[model samples]
Target: MSHSMRPLLPNSPNPPRIETSSSSSSSSQHRTKRVATPAACEACRRRKSKCSAERPRCSVCVERQTPCEYTTLPTETHLRAQRRKLSNLEIRCQAYEDLFGILRSRSEEEIAQILQRLRTGEDAQTIVKTVQDGDLLLQLSLKPEFRFRYIFPYSGEMPRHLKDAQNPYIRSLLYEKTVTHLVQPPMYIETLKEISDESQKMYIAPYHTVELDDPRISSMIVSNWTTVSSDNPMLRMLLQIYFVFEFPFHPCFHKDFFLEDMFIGITRFCSPLLVNAVLATAWHGYTRMKNRAEYWQPHNLGYRFLAEALRLFELEQETPTITTVQAAAIINLVYNLNGIDELGWVYTHKSFGMAQKISLFTPNPEESTEWQMVAGVTAWCLFNWQALITFHTFQPPVINDPPSRPLPDVDEEPAYYGEILVKYPFGKEPVRIYNGSVFKAISQFRVILNDITKSFFNPSRTYSPISFEAAIEFRSKLRIWYEDLPQPLQARHIVLPCHLKIHIHYHIVLISLFEPHLHTDNAYNGVNPDMIVSQSRICFETLMRIYYLRHGFECLDTTLVQFLHLLGFSTLDEISVTENGSAANEAIRSTLMLCAKGLWEQGQNYYLSEAVFRMLRQSMSVEDVTILGDIVEVEDGDGPLNLMAQELRSRWPIGAFSKADDSKDRTLEHFIHWWQQYSEEKAQDISAMEQDGPVVPPRYPQRYGT
Candidate 1:
């Protein structure tokens, strides 16, 4: 094309020349001479931009012409072949060295040498050609049954590519025994039996590996759907879960692991069926109720999976849907975001990451998938809101500076506390924070519940006052029963400890605050004893109902007696209050005595008898005292009461305040009446005192009462 643009070959053996002439006779002579050259005009050397030697048209034709016809040089196939052969030779040599290095690294002898050294009962040797076969052969060789020896012990050589065997007899062993053991997952069921029957952690699934995070496992799951059994719902669930929660790790490896080129390799490898199966499994898990406990329970694999599933569903919602079931399914799946507010679940760390990822693909609100994802995320957000609302009820407002002594008029709206439901004291911030969190969580639950139900044309059901009251009592009694239990047994009996406790607390605070509204018998216009008692009953019933509904028989019959007694009802199946009180008092006394003994051992001066006396007096009712029988005599006399009286008498001095028998007799009557009143009043006080027992430190030894 141009003189300077002529093709130059670095390996060329020779260069060509070109000539041009003005005269026809000179051109004729030049043409005759130049016709013998093999190379084309494009490959010819030229002086500046012009040709020198004359040809058929000469220099005048070349200068005047706008175009020059030139034949380009062809590549030398022989030279190319020679270069290719050199490259192939280099590659072959490198491969041979790599193979040798691999074999040395693995401490393996040449196949021929291994075969020559083979003894009786040696493991089988495999010779493979392909890389896959080499890998398999290597795996077989590493088995425990294979007794491979290194040529150089100190060199620490390892096996190379046995399949491309320079030597062909490297023995590979099938570790039948080891493989069998591996195949047989250990029976943790037996070890579980050794523990007391009261353990709950036993119910938690065993964690062999967090497979959802494993790239290889994830890829295999996504790419090999045909081989995956339908019965392995867990696997499918897990894959979907991972896809949603852990979007980065797809098929199993990170999408970025393909060097930001996307998981082209893995995606290419995954058949369409595998992708469908994974998605189907996820959708299935979301629609079914089987995963609720597994999904929502804090820190479980199900939770991780559910989170991932939500993400995947959010991503998938952009496409067309066949039915409302799919819509409802996706909505319900996102509804689980509400469950993320549970203890030990930090949404900021886990769920927020998913949100950010979602934001990347979803920016427009009008898009259907965006809306679906938004609805799901909003449902999650609402759950937090519900938690926040629940938190405010129990949380006392903490007023700072000019204290929030009086609430503002309903008409005077503030940004935060303007809403009647949110109007709480700023002083009780701690409790408010706790209640707020619960309110937020519950609100999210309600929101998602409403949203999904509405989508499916099923309106959400609000709890009626009666239902709400039932819920309160049910949960409160459940709490009391749970708290009354021996500590170890409590956790086992309770399904969700935080939820149970929160429910009780929330109801208690609500009833206390809204007694005027919550009371059953509106007889006492506002905040009266009837109101208090009715509100209390409402709380108690609600708590109990919720507890029973949430956790079944393990908590059944638990607070039946205390609950009936609180409600002023009697039941034949109930334990007598007197019996319970007596037992409680005895336990309290025994505990106090043990504490007193410890104080005594520590060289404390006061008698443990005094502490024991205080504990009994504080914990025992007249009924308890009566049941104690002869133990109620004075210290100077035979009974506990007499003993106490003797001590009082000694302190007061019986003779100092009395005149003759007339004054003494009147005083005696007054004293007896006063004593009865005091005993009656002190009974409840004592019971309360025992209930306020301390947690004994482990290092302290138990002591019997004084």
Candidate 2:
């Protein structure tokens, strides 16, 4: 046979041909597969071979130096879209031709019948549906016959000098056609133009404007734009205007824009630029100008200032490195100035901005400087204070009631500071400062409160009702963090001591805020004016006594102690009055007596009432003479004390209930009796400490050890 016509057979002497075919099949099966195999380019296709989709040239194209083009399969949706567009264009052209024919022939009745038939058909033009008033207006503009008559309302008042100034109606029609007619979703173009013109005239602000005769239409446009939100520049600009200006500053403000609601809306609806602007303005304005009463108008009352503060706090706690002491100070100033009355206001909402700040300012030991850490701590404290206050506010309601309503859907998905720590598109970062321990401590304290608050609310019978548990936990955490800090930082910052007394003071304050009635629950009639005044007196007395007791006048920064003295904590017995040279001891006795009396009488707890007087009568040597000179008067009368003591002594022991002595022997009767006294005693002690600012340890020598 000829060589050209010959074909290889497996039985022939060439065994390699059969093996090659087997190998080829095996390799094909084992080959790594791509999503789609790249095909030969057009240039390579013409030559009939493989082509790699490479830049400048594919392998075949490179060698041959020919142009290459890669082809991809069009998606089904894309092909459908293309066909639909073509079909619509065809319909538009047909309608145009039909209309022109009707106009040219002047066949009005025939045109009407054709239009009616087209309207009933499936593939008719959208404009052919029922003709609207706007359609008539459009037809007048399009038909040269009606155009002049429609434009000039009057019969014949054409002025030769105003030739260029054509009819107003004609001018409007032409302007709309030129500028807006081609845009889709056919709006009343003339109406929008009129609104634009009117708004410009009234507001005197030359900006892009969209108008509609229907207020609902304008609202729908605003609402729809919000619904189709994107992180694009145009969308952000729209959001800024809608939130900051249109929503807040518009002449017609909505009633839904309550103070808290307005602020919440701004936080939710505004662009980041608008948020930052409002925040900076609010912060700087509050700090530099006047308080909210002066700076904020009645119209601005609906913004939730408290919630924003809480948001700031949450942000700081998550990322303490970037937030600063100044930020904390500013927040503190705001909080105090506003005189935060309810916890719910603080708890109502969380903040993304705060969360973002935390993430951006996350701390690193090697990279972070001291100032940065301080700022971070400050921010952290601000966040914790927010949560802490909210938690505090919620605790009482949770304790007293199951919940009148489902806990306000305020904060959900409590944001982690680290989540937002990445660099933002805007090159803004939180304030940085040194020593983040304060922030950490405050954060833990708030967290402790949160845990306790939650525990109090949790539907568990085993949970203790004692408020001290939270205080103890908070004190423990505070101590751990405080002690761990370097001594220099502590000395410089005046790190607050997390002692029993300090904890007690807060406990009373919290109780007062949450359940003021708890102060006089045991008192006769529960509405005693004397009891109320006494409770107030005890609170002040305790706080002041603690200040002098724990950190004596000598222990305190002398200037601070002197300042306190100057502020009006005058001593009772002068050096000249104690001629017996027992001035120090007598004065110390009198100070302790005053503190005990203040706590016993003012605090409406019967058990504490008896315990305080008993301790006062059982004289003990005084080690701190400074306390005697540092006492402040209760300023209120003492009838509540006598009544409380009489009630307690009649019902329980004269001595305060010692838990150690009573725990094993504790019966329901004994426990009730002891608790009655203990609760009273504890309440008084806490009140005293709260009032005194420093708590005094008992003066007796080693009673527990002996």
Candidate 3:
């Protein structure tokens, strides 16, 4: 403060002077030292040289005349190191989740074994890695997809193993390949297997949009869940039934894209409306206890799903996607299956109108390169189904004609085969694949069908009535379509239900075209009545003969009901007008009762069946009912059918359907046996005839038009 001990003032002229003090220091130097006193500096550590622990610099650093730096990582380097540790922890957590999912579906014994392995000190990542890399699948996974859509139907690539074949027909043809799969491999419920119906019960709840892949999603979708939050067991079951049974025949949306999008939480090719609609359509899978009143009740699983779908439909009605159009159509199918025909037609109109609005009928060129190979498949499927329903109801089509979208090139990709449960002649519920190519075949055939529908049921049909000549042309077209079918879809090909359905659909159109003409024009126009009767009879008898193989007539195909209604009424009409209860009418009466029996069995599962059954009963007179009294069932709760069942139960003490008397020739059981025998004999006769003079598959139809 002072120089030479002079007086120091506040404003001294010569105040500057240096004074030495041991304590005075800059405040900055008080900070904790960067390098530890007990450790070598970074330079010494790097050189692997022994060093004195120093305050600022190590002796090794001093000797080298280099800056002595401490071991303090930079911000980025520190963050990187921390990130690696976090990543390792995250991986371990993921392994735990995967293991938990795997162990959940396993039996208690398996859980015990796995838990024991874990408890005995197996590391999670190690165990998870082993499980992932191995063939031991204890958890649900994507079923080993055959990607059958990629396998060409006409490929020269011989399947080294039948199991490896693209078509189920190839796998089913060999004697040694008669094995059947009862239930599909586990799908969905991947992380929620332990969740009870209560835990994951599907209901409209507070929704937050899931992270979606498609940016085109609307505000409504952005604010709402696309489907119910989690995959409940009911949802899982219905999904299985839908993809396996309904999708192939319909082929409304691309299955592969929907499935992938579904798992990834994306609403691109899938939506709440579409998922719920498909689930509602597949609600026919509720075959647990057939006599339960819940089959048609609002409390039923399907109805609940349908309600949610309709809610979403209302919300997104202003901002529709291709999925919305698909949803609306499938919802119509739900109504159709339930026999709500008017609603079905209304939705049919709605869905197709939506399709038109979205320009699906004439898709954008950019749309052709979108995710699904068949971008327009939904539009094609929608109107075609509407056409079929319209044809049956004798209602005008929803559209004057389906817009000319080229038929989907199904062979453009490997065919996707949905493993649906099918009943075979071999007495097994064999899992059959509804080949994507089969639907392609249907699309081709539908071109002619669409033409036929327009010819007969066009709104303007009164101006240009469905004349005999036009009918002949359409008839020729149908026959040609039948002959031109791919080898596996031919009339004689009994490989899949879809094959039979295609044949049935073809024959129904033929029956509609010819039956009215049968007694008049067909008889005089060289159209054989025998051929028409034989055609329908064989198809239907085969269905009845093999009913046990096809889930015992649990309304597997709702469209079948429409076809049955047509075939059934015409067949019953022949005997319904009969007055005499003589031996001449007995056989026909038995056959008619068998038809009623089919309806009666269906009634056990569907109110639509009960409704159709009532309509059929209404067509018969008291005398006709009396003539078929012992054998025929009239309708439920209408006294006759219940009484008959009661009477049989009282007298015969019947157990189950399979336990019913075979000797009682008038009983349904006896008819099933009789029909089976008749079908076998007919098949043998046809086979022998083919051997004597082979009836070659008809040539590709000359009338096919793009």
Candidate 4:
């Protein structure tokens, strides 16, 4: 208490020490030098080592002579985490680059203004709205007529107003003529009385029944009776094939009644025109299946029957029954299939006229359903024929008046089985082919084709080429149409032949829609060359698919010819313009060659096919010729094939050269010379035949029956 207690009062540092026992001394020493925990340094944390608490630097880091830094934030220890951070940085850089790229075209002042607005916290949507509501946008919304005035102030009605303004001199002359006519009791009145008796005699004519005995009708009657009685196997097979393959696609008759009449030997009940037409079609189908060229002969049985059918058709032209009109349409189809487009058009026109004369479009309600069905079928046949001819000729349809009657419903179930129905093996199956659905699809396509013609190829609108905008719109509609087709009409559900045909037509429509753009140069039209190439590839690829499937020849008709023509020209154009050959270009060339050879081998006698074949042969590059055999020069006796070749040479001179080689020109010249020689020979033969009253080829008997 004397020294320690007195010194501990205020600021004495050395007066607090006290003495204790050994255990107490140890506890007091521990309390005086207590240690606290500290966070690890960055180096120790990364190295996974414990650190000794020290001033400014940790012991472990100091001992290792590494930089020591303390931090509260955690350090990434996994490789994946590092990668994620790097990826985020890269994405930010990319976004910045894209933003700069988009603004590269803008003026620096504009970009600066935009950045300033963003920095100032202006809303992006509000800025955009302000810009859109500017005066420039408002002016752009005004009508073109209100924005610009014509140089001439004349109104459209000025000419009409001038004509309507009456002249005083003309009115005075009219009044004088009226007065003169009243004073002079018109001399023409007495003259008219004197001629009235003559007019009556002229209007009246003697009526007499012209005794016209048609030998073909007599022959048809005899043959029908004999053929039915003998049960000719060839005739039966031919009829079976006709019913199976042909009639199903085009059903114009009541199958049960037609078969009953044929089998029961009911001469009075049967139509001579229909019978003869069936016989001719059967003969053709039989010959085609037999792979014979006999049908080409003028005196062949098919031709004979066709001639007799025409004779009967002409005899009853004045009073054309439904059967007569149907028979005529069938005959027209036969001609079309045979590639005689002119003759087909002639017969089609005749049938359409007959349909109109008989009011087939407006049928009587009192008639039986069978009669209504026949009338509907006849109307469809006419529509189909007109659509085909119009597409092939690139002309407006002749029979443009829409049918007054509605098309047969696709959902109408078949009730009875007759000759045609019996021939179909899948008649009872769930996925059977319905003629109604096919007709409806065809009707829809006809409507589209008519629209295309009227919009693009209208004769009245001479300057109207198809705009690219309109084409895209139409192409979308066609795609939807194909996609929305009924199950029976779809490619997967229908027979391969029918499926191929429907898709072929669809692709053809696509081609037609896009073809006009290939020649256009308008920037606003948005004509994409790559799109044209793609569509053309699809079209030719579809044709190649048909060829590989072996349905090429059977489906060959004028449409096929027209499609080939388009393909050949488009291929030539692509080859000419494209300097560096691509795989697509080569594939198109090879496919074109295959199509040409296929059409040439089939030899359907279509002028278009022959022209296309000749053109491809002449236009092919030497390399193409080597890959697809050398152009075979044949002495074809058909008419001039040079028209297409000359046209091609005129349109695309670059097609004559292969990568700027002169040898291609020589090859083209040589082929052209050969074509010229063949054309000359054909002309001579035609002239000689005309002088000699037509050279009739030798006749061939019917293959099946006598």
Candidate 5:
């Protein structure tokens, strides 16, 4: 037969083929037989016949009506693939087991409680504590994949500004050294037990008092009391303003109780010092609101009331109570309002001392009285005030350190003074009452402020440059604290005084964080010039915002003055680097001038403001003279111009003039003469420039440029 016509079959000594008897039977009976190898099938192997290795059943086994099975081991490649699949399954099983273990350890009740609190907007720290106590958090933390899942899940998407490593403030906070130092276990007061006795006595010393023998002082106090008791129109208005404006920012007393007491003729029961302090604070706020310059004089109504309050406080024979501490804090605030920072610091110190004496810092847990809550809030206020003073004056805080006692939880209490309706972007609604949460947040920020002061601004500490990492960590914490604030406290556009103050303080901390870089040419080594300029602009913008909000009224306090001083120095530095008459340079100059003019107007008792104003004026005069091409020579300080330059150089080391170019320096006297002669000419140019645009840079000779 031909190869094409032959039936296919396995090779064998004798191939079997069926013969057809009939056409139909032939088609069915004629079949091809397949061969099997030795390894193909058990049936074929046992029968000693060749079989095809097909799946399910080999051809030889099928034709014989027997089952087929392979008994060979798998190849190494196949085994490896199977082992990989099994390993993946084992890993998934282990993960599930870990999750189940965590769930098993946490009771349903505990998890339910945590979920309920989270739904109700409980503080993040409280919720974290709940989970941590249940040990579920611990398990999650132990695993690398789940470490940040619960605690800091949002860390992956931080704000762009925060993530920028080139940003000086952020850079400082990100420094590894800073993070390590900040996160270390706090150093406890090891000598607490040893010094407990002495500390108690020392704290109480501020409250020890002799009975008042001065009849005049007592009569003045009595008169002030009569005025408050009678509710004269002016006094009533002041009190209302205090409640509406000042009290929210500095809540020393419960508003409802104070108002109720006043209405019920309970003024007699209240301490005279406390009453006088309130009157003084109210009057101070009123005068500032009214922009009454005369009322800020030494013997004005505010000062008289403040003096009487101090006199009564000094004469009290009893131990200082919550009211007494409140009185001291109010009086301290009054001092700050009058731009007497030294006195403000003194009074704040006394208030903190009295607060410590009464154990306000370490309150009795058994007591849940309103007074206890007020005392706790007062302690935190004192801490905030102390931090501000420390930052501004570069002084160490007299309050020792942050208290270990937790802040009072008073959110459940009724809102003080009912709901204060405030007009906001979301329409008029009751402003959120400042409660324990606000107090606690501010207290926490104060602790950070204290650290910053010690690390960067403390005059007593040995000079230590703040690492970029430390600054960034602090800044990060501040930002997180702000971001995590309750909706009510996070209003930026509402213009609530208390809320504004919080915002201002936050920016103040930011300014302080960048202030070190401002003096990069002097102390801060290797800091970028761009960073200094940017930070200075931030400070100016923040100050300008405050100025616009208050419109220069009631904003001349120590903190404000210090802010302006820093702004002045920073502006001068900015001007020194930027080209004169350029838009950037002029904008900085305008801000400096505006700040100087404002400070000069309100800077009667404020020495710091006066100094800042003078510096700004000097800087402006130097810029003007330089623009007019009046270069002065200082060779051995022979001429009046040379003397003037030397004096200017001494006063302002970071002045507009380049130190390398000794001929650029000009003395105050020489500057004054030049200003007098150039005033009219400059006015016309400035006016024209204001109407048109920035003045063109004037061409100068090579010697003059030098």
Candidate 6:
């Protein structure tokens, strides 16, 4: 306590007294006192000014009207007094020095902050450390803002623009740090506490790291890339596109936080390879870029971006990161979309291999960081993606075990962030509802689908006994899943393309499951031909709505094409058995026409669709096939999609369809000629059947495991 604040005793000869109080001490002549304090500012003494003293003045000192103090050292709490006075003097000295600095006015905010700290009684050393560690003050110290870009490790595939940088940042970049793959997942704060507290086992490790510090790569990257991000303009634009269009279905990474991390340069979730891979996949969404048609071309901007990611993948393969797996998976998606199945499968193996090496399949939620839980959620997504593709393409999945991780808490950001905005896709007023409701729903549904894949489908067809009861069991689970879906995601309520896609996918999977059992089962008469026809009609109508609404853009997707052609194959089978004008026949015809039109529409976006459409036509009579092609286009309709299709199809790779003599001719006439030739050949086979006692058609491997 200061002398003025100390209690006064009436008996004391020199009792401390307030000047305002009526007392004998006040009437006495105001006596001067001499005092000294430890660590008083020498600078202030030299200047002959009052310095570093903020304590209240005594009554005698106030009555004497002194401007400064001359006192003996503080007698009480002497040690504490010395430290406090010393810290105060040091802080004041810093303030004085900053006041005359050449950049004094520029650091007004920083200096004011320091003064505020002093007033708040913070220790001097802490304030100094804070200022030293922070960049804001250092930045203000420069005339122009200092450029403090970080050099990220580059692969041989570092974009050609930024090699051989001579800056200090590259010196650190040249040090190849052997890092583990601990890719963070999309996490919400609410679900974090539910995560397991178990420590991760370090037994399984994806090892190997090399110094990727090629001076050439540094030059190529120049100053374009940062520790967590690249300066690519396309990275930002395509990322938004991927989230808006693709993320709703997959929900692979947490969209909002992932974007925030990219902007603020957080390294855990976002990486250079992942960014480029995302860009490559999102390239399909770049429908109207300067009137160019580079959908599947090797030399487009997105492909070049993939080329960079490819090199990075090789460079980072030995020491795989969570983002490396993500990048590889996305690259697989792009390649598969373009019908590069071998490369797509190759990358799938690569991605799945990395996932295995990192023990991503092993659930270790104990003592979990939010990122680990996120990785768990993301693991589910990647496993589903890998499983679905593998099952569809006749390859068994390598990632067999499902991860047991905490579910994303849906109510966390329930109101904001993920509101779905459906526009022209709907005829009524658009609905805007929270999108996160479906994420958990999709994850749960994929779990069942993964089970179905392991049970029935494989390259060897090991589970051969096509049990009608088992199919019914699987179908029951599907119904239960649909019934349990959130209200907005249900039929008549779904508005977004992402929601509609799940519905269509459900019915398509049902069709594939039931189609093979129809011919050989008397015990399973529950699945009649009419039932199959109804499902086909549902898929056709739902699919056409998606295409015509300008909402769905899976036109670049070959898997959707596979589904479309599967419906066509069923429609053809129906045509052989049903008479014209019958309900089944009429259903078959509508399904066939819509399927053909869908192929034609999808072909406008990708050349492969046109060839696939005509190939289906060769199975029907010329008169019937021509009728399928005579349908009118949707009115005032698909304006955006039509433009995208036109632009995308404007240029094609030289050998897009096939390198036949007439390959260059993509005109309708050339296709018709080809279809007619195939039809005539089929007719010749029919003629040979009369003599050869029913010639069998060319064999196709069993489409369904049955």
Candidate 6, superposed: residue stretches over 4 Å from native:
1-235, 289-298, 366-369, 412-434, 457-465, 524-559, 575-590, 604-611, 617-621, 624-706
Q: List candidate 4 stretches off by more than 4 Å.
A: 1-231, 247-261, 264-270, 287-299, 415-431, 457-464, 469-473, 491-495, 519-533, 543-547, 550-569, 575-586, 604-706
Model 6 scores worst on lDDT over the 10 consecutive residues at: 201-210
- The per-prediction CA RMSD against the true structure, in angstroms, equals 28.8, 29.9, 18.8, 35.9, 32.8, 21.8
Clashes, model 5: 15
What is the lDDT for 578 in model 2? Answer: 40
Of the candidates shown, which would achieve the greatest lDDT relative to the real structure? 3
| Ranking of models by TM-score | 3, 6, 4, 5, 2, 1
Rate residue 11 of model 4 by lDDT: 70
Residue 244 lDDT, candidate 6, scale 0-100: 53
lDDT of 1 by residue, 473-513 (tens): 43344445435443222322322323344334333433433
Model 1: per-residue Cα lDDT at residue 99: 39
Higher-ranked by TM-score: 4 or 6: 6
Q: Is candidate 1 or candidate 3 better by lDDT?
A: 3
Mind giving the per-residue lDDT tens digits that candidate 5 earns over 1-706? 6456667777888776655568657676656543323354567768888767666788887887887876542322334656767876864554343333333434587557655776897854444434433332221112222210111111212223233444333222112222222221222122222333331211111100101122222112122353323223234444544554555555665555444444544652256688788777666434322333233345466666777788888875257876687788788766655434445666676777787787877768786665554555566666776776655544555665776555534455544222332221112122343444555566777888877767753466643546655666677788888787655456332223354456556765665565454444433345453464455445335434333322232322334444455555555556667787776666655555544545554444333344334434445544543432322211211232222222221122222211223454332233434444544465567565477654332222112222
**Model 3 backbone overlap count:** 9
Better of 1 and 2 by TM-score: 2
Q: Considering only N, C-alpha and C atoms within 3 Å, which residue pairs clash in candidate 3?
A: 148-415, 149-413, 149-414, 149-415, 149-416, 150-414, 150-415, 226-272, 423-549
- Which candidate's TM-score is highest? 3
Model 2 Cα shift for residue 508 (angstroms): 8.6
Q: What is the C-alpha lDDT of each candidate?
A: 0.29, 0.32, 0.51, 0.50, 0.48, 0.50
Going through the candidates in order, what is the number of backbone clashes in each?
Answer: 104, 48, 9, 0, 15, 30
lDDT assessment of candidate 6: 0.50
